[model samples]
Target chain A: MAAAVETASHIRAARRGSIRGSRRKALFWSYFFLVLFVVIFLAPPFYMLITSLKSSGEISAQVNPWWVFHPTLENYLGLLTEPNFVTFFRNSAVVSLCVVAISMLISVPAAFALARMKFWGSATLATGVFLTYLIPESLLFIPFFRIFAFLRDITGIEFLNHWWVLIIVYPTLSVPFCTWILISYFASIPKELDEAALIDGAGYIQMLTKIFIPVALPGIIAATIFAFTVAWADFLYPLAFTTSADQLVLPVGIVTTLIKGDVYNWGQIMAGSLICAAPPLIIYAFLMDYYIAGLTAGATKG
Target chain B: MAEAVMSGVRAPAARRSSLRAIARRKPMIAFMMALPLILLILLLVVYPALYSIHLATLNRSMKRFVGFGNFLFLFKRDTFWMVVKQSVIFACTAVFFKTLIGIFLANFVHTIPTKGQRKWRGMLMVSWVIPTAISSITWFWLFDPSYSAFNWLLAKFFGTAPIPWLGEPLWARFCVILVNIWAGTPFFMIMYLAALKSVPEQLYEAAAIDGANWWQRLWYVTLPMMRNIISITVLFSLIVTFANFDIVRILTNGGPVDQTQIFATWAFQVGIQGNDIPLGASVSLFMFPILGVSAYFILRGVRRRSQEI
Candidate 1:
């Protein structure tokens, strides 16, 4: 009881003294590290920007490396005009967008059911869904490759080196995690809200469309962003599956097309790497709150 | 008291619920909602995982059953055990540093003012959100032998020759670990920071009033409060790092005499590069024990925590 009284008084004193001498020191330290941390985090992309602005001769000059003699936008313009780079970006965008759409269609309702419903195997299935997220794509790639080969044999339609191949593969990553988060977010909502809607003679589909989706907008956005970023930035699947220039995603295309046999085009490679990283970086910079919310949703549920 | 009486008056008229109507219909609705998820898991996840098991057992490359020959062949290889050792080393070391650094960073971030805290929080999360493949490419450039900025900086600062980050065996392993730490630690930091916020301020205030030093307060109050969270985060990191593929793949491609090869990359090499699918399956199967143990602990921890709550 004395400890409790002392604690209450101490808290009051701390609140009173928050504007006093030692607090400023703490504030300064916090801001100082915050700035330093920001710089450390942001430096690589800054270095990439500088590298992208330099010419190949400048980049490899063996002189003072940090400063460019002649800053040029030539690499950026040249890369934009490069026929294969454009195709790669377009293919990546299309594949990523389609994967997002597909993941949402499957995951949102499934997450809702697991979160809100009580079925015989619902809980077990939820765990099963999360376990799929844990299966590394590296392990699955060879089997998937063989399955595609078999598909070609039976259907006389080749799935290899096709952009649409990702539409089939990307779901393997997105759905499980998306379902997991959606389930968590869905569970947090009050049951009475849904019950009221049900009592109003709203069908399951209508209630989902009208209520749950709107309420869970942040979680949905997080899942969509995750799917887009994963599909956009995937390397192994594209490296293993797609052989053609036209079919490649940004990550694989930049590496394969730019790096020739025993020779590295340092300028174009850095430039392409920067370009590929930009969208996700920009999105992350702006939408970090929603992203963190989405990420920790799983931790809470698990 | 007045509001309680008012609500009680309205409660009786709203009690027209039929038990059978509610019980039978709700189960049907729940099942209907869950159908797509069940089908997807069965078709996509269960089938593929089970199919891989069957593939692991047999040597049916040309529709022929070679029995346990694949496992026998894998057991006889020298590199298989080396890969296992390296994977455990990589996962343990990376998870250890990531969890430690993450906790420290989270504590540092948590003590800051709210307005400043959010900005730093967002900045730190960039490492986690910047698609792993794209950032791995950037790291590849940093470790590039000829024109790497990191090597350039190291040379300028230390007055030493440029380090062959990707070409040397031990250095290549270290570089991958560094890159993995860079990419992964933010995930733990965020989780810990969220856990930190849930801790009540009164606990700290009480410790302060008792004349406990900062370290003692942390040991007594913070550690006890965040212990479960720390374990969960570490276990999660262990599973992820054990199965990691992209960073090692992009950075080294498991080269420099295969010095840095972990299980996933080794599996890829054997299966895809060496054209030995059965051997690859055996190598990939090695990941099961690590994941299985971590998953069991995580689930049990989760259950204990849930029951406590």
Candidate 2:
């Protein structure tokens, strides 16, 4: 009787183990779909890498169009060594860095005031600032062209096709959004910190420097990254404003120089693009969480 | 101890700490702190925007007021109507797909346990955080007629004829919209995911206990719960897609035959390319009313929901 009972129990355990194995297979299929989704989404950049690595002849001959052959570093080498590409990179770096510095200079204090001070029209002004983001860059270019022309004529200082032209243009894009983000972050800080600082006879400036700046460091970093990326990757403004190859940023630079008229130098074009995309890709790989936090803050608040 | 406590309260009360005293001292410092941003916005955004409007009304030479003549001329053009229709089509179709796919993906990803959440979330955000212009170029390459991997894959899998992804007008429009959707949907995915996480599991549990299936649970519990985020995201996406220029420009440069010309691209053509400043301003300014209405509803919806929550 004991032997029969033990055999029956073992059979039951075996059946249960197989059923559990099938359930695991179902979960695997579900994960497979998610993995496939990522591959499809990531195809363009991956394809870009392959194309950038191929030689011009291979790209043109179209032998197994998806595969890279005679893998060469020629295009990257050429791009990096080219004087014009170097100039474009330099100009982009300068514009992006300056925009970050200038944007922070303006946005931080404005955020402080809006968060702390009970000023007249402060709420109205905050809303107004966000509305500025709705205005497209396409609209701004024409008026900018005319205004710059007028400035050149009056002040005898030529602003068109110059790097400094971006210095003037970028703030229009960065300042409003940065201020809104900074304001939101500052407001979320506890009121007691400022009260304690005030009790210590710390002035507003002292409080901003001593209390707010260190606390809101992540928001500031996120804003800086934003300002940098906007100034770096902006295409329309550079396309319209800068006609000179020497003055162009990466986006307009690669398109105009490599793919002209009807002939696309696909290999070199892809190579130039990868170089241009490197910085932001690196920034993103490191700081993606902070970036998303900054972007969604407005939505959550609104 | 009682005497010391009384002395402390009396000593603190002996000094005047009036609101007027604080304001009198810190008003200058507050203004000083705020002065830079005020000046920057005034010079850059506020002044240029107003100046642009002023310049749009006046003649090209700015010597005389044209008095809506440029706007009138814009209305007279055949291309303007074509652009309007195309813009609506682009924004609506793109927003539709983005919201649909975004919500679907969010739901799919959410079915996984919390431990597996971060991996998928990171993958979804990859498309979003990459700079727009760079990714647009990558898409541009992928849609190239003679050498697109998308077509190559299609050929390999199905033995189909090569479709001119950007050569034909309708196909070109579809391609542009497809790329726009691809680039944009990740944004919606993240937003929906955040909203989905906030949805209490008890509602789903209660619904399931009452005999609701997956579809029913999604319809009743998920949809209603995510309504505010959905509406706001749709509105915001609509606005951005309408104003979008990069994807369209990079993909087809406004088309095989101006078939993909939305308002923003059309504005670029007429304003800067055609040297018709007033016309471009008028075209761009057309976006204002739609933007205003959407902004109103979105802000109101958010406020109402937040109060409820």
> Each prediction's DockQ?
0.37, 0.33
**lDDT at A72, model 2:** 96
- The digit string of per-residue lDDT tens for model 1 on B117-232 reads 88788788777766677678777877778888877887888977988889998898898898899888888889989888889999987776575655686689988998887897
Quantify all predictions' global Cα lDDT against the true fold: 0.77, 0.78
Question: How far off is each candidate at the interface, as Cα RMSD in Å?
Answer: 6.7, 8.0
Give the per-residue lDDT digits (tens) of candidate 2, residues B155-268. 989988888888898998898888888788888988888889889989976775565655787799999999988998999888888888888888887877788998888878
Query: What fraction of correct interface contacts does each candidate retain?
Result: 0.40, 0.38
Off by over 4 Å in 1: A1-37, B1-29, B60-62
Highest-DockQ candidate = 1
| Per-residue lDDT of candidate 2, residues A1-302 (tens digit) | 99999999887677566545644653565477678778877777778788999888888785676778689998899888889888888988899999999999988998787777745555666666667765667667777877888899999999898877998898878888888778777877777687667667777788889988999888887888889888988888887788888988888888777777787778778888888888887897788777767776656652
lDDT of 1 by residue, A216-248 (tens): 899998888888888887877887789888899
Write down the TM-score of every candidate: 0.91, 0.90
TM-score for the A-chain in each candidate structure: 0.89, 0.89
Candidate 2 residues lying further than 4 Å off, grouped into runs, are: A1-33, B1-20, B59-63, B305-309
